[model samples]
Target: MRALVTGAGRGIGRAVAEHLSGRGYRVALTARNEDELHKAAAACAGETLVVPADITSAVDQVFDRVEAAWGGVDVLVANAGAGSSAPVHRITDEDWSRMLELNLTAPFRCVRRAVPGMVAAGHGRIVVIASVAAKRGDPYVAAYTASKHGVLGLVRSAAAELAGAGVTVNAVCPGYVDTPMTDTTVAEVAAKTGRDPARVRATLAAKQPVGRLVSPAEVADAVWFCVGNGAVTGQGVDVSGGAVQS
Candidate 1:
């Protein structure tokens, strides 16, 4: 199988790419950072192609390059996303737009671009890395929450549309993950509340019922399940450590 993973330079994306590659899939790693892409490619156990491009605007270019290297992508992991925290009333227009572009619109464009090829081939798997916010609301992150919800809707609708095409679309919604992104969130909360960064980090971890932050590899495991199961389409598989029971 051939796979293309966006934001494959690090964190959940990197974990997914490495996992698929270890399973004998030829993977393509794409992110905005060329150096990081190369480093990620080097860590893959199987063959890899590194394509560095901003997913929001270069979806077509990334797919075209992948198509040229391999026949086409058999698995598409839309895992590139960003989050911003602000009171609902204080959220800026730019921040809202950024969240939507990165979290929702980019995945939609990727799904749209990869569908025709998958339909022709008669089999494919697409997983979007969403969040617990996609399932329920959280304070100080209205824009981020809205974007994740929109992406989950996209996954459900696309899965329904492609149900008969041998294509599966799903979302993996995770809670606070132990990653650089979470580190940023910790720092931001500490700066805002005048609390120690360690305390802020611990508080975020406590939000999950597991009493710890989710691992990138754990989220990758959920993505693997989505790809391996043919009948599990249109579902948001929560990797939130029991924080989300629905």
Candidate 2:
């Protein structure tokens, strides 16, 4: 099998890429960070192609490279995204546009590129790494939440359109994950609020019923399930540790 994972340089993307590689798939890894992409490729258990480019403009290059080497992509995990905390009133146009571009538009473009081949081949899986914010809104980070909501919208619409085409589109929604992104958030919260970073981290973790932050591997497992399960499509499978139930 052949799989392509975006934002594979680190966090949940890296975990999913590594997991899929372990399952015997030749993986194409993409991210903006060249060093990080190579590091992720090196950790993969199977064959890997490191394509370092901005995902927003690099989808065609990704497809070209993957097709050139492996025929076509059998699976695509559109895991590339970014988030920020800004009140709705304070969010600038640039912030809103960037979030939408990274979290919603880029994934849709990837799906558009991959669907034709999948439709012809009669088999394909696409997973978008969304967030619990997609389901439940929170204070601040309005742009992130809106972008994630748009992701689910895309997933559902695409799934409906491709119902009989042997291509499945789904999403994995994770909550307060223990990744570098969360670490940065923790640090920022601590620095601004005059609290210990460790305490801030704990507070974030405590929001989950599991009493801890979710792991990248857990989200990766959800992605694996989405790709491997043919019966599931247009579903937002939550890996939010009971933080989201709907």
Once model 1 is optimally superposed onto the true structure by TM-score, how far is the C-alpha of residue 84 displaced, in angstroms? Answer: 0.1
Residue-wise lDDT of candidate 2 within 137-211, one digit each (tens)? Answer: 899989999999999999999999998999999999999998989999998888888999999999999999999
Q: What is candidate 2's CA lDDT for residue 141?
A: 86
Q: Deviation in angstroms for 144 in model 1? A: 0.3
- Per-candidate TM vs. native? 0.99, 0.98
Instruction: Write one digit per residue (lDDT tens) for candidate 1, span 105-193.
Output: 99999999999999999999999999999999989999999999999999999999999999999999999999889999999989999
Model 2 spans > 4 angstroms off: none
Q: What lDDT does the true structure give each of the candidates?
A: 0.96, 0.94
Candidate 1 RMSD to the correct structure: 0.6
Clashes of each: 0, 0
Tell me the deviation in Å of residue 48 in model 2. Answer: 0.8
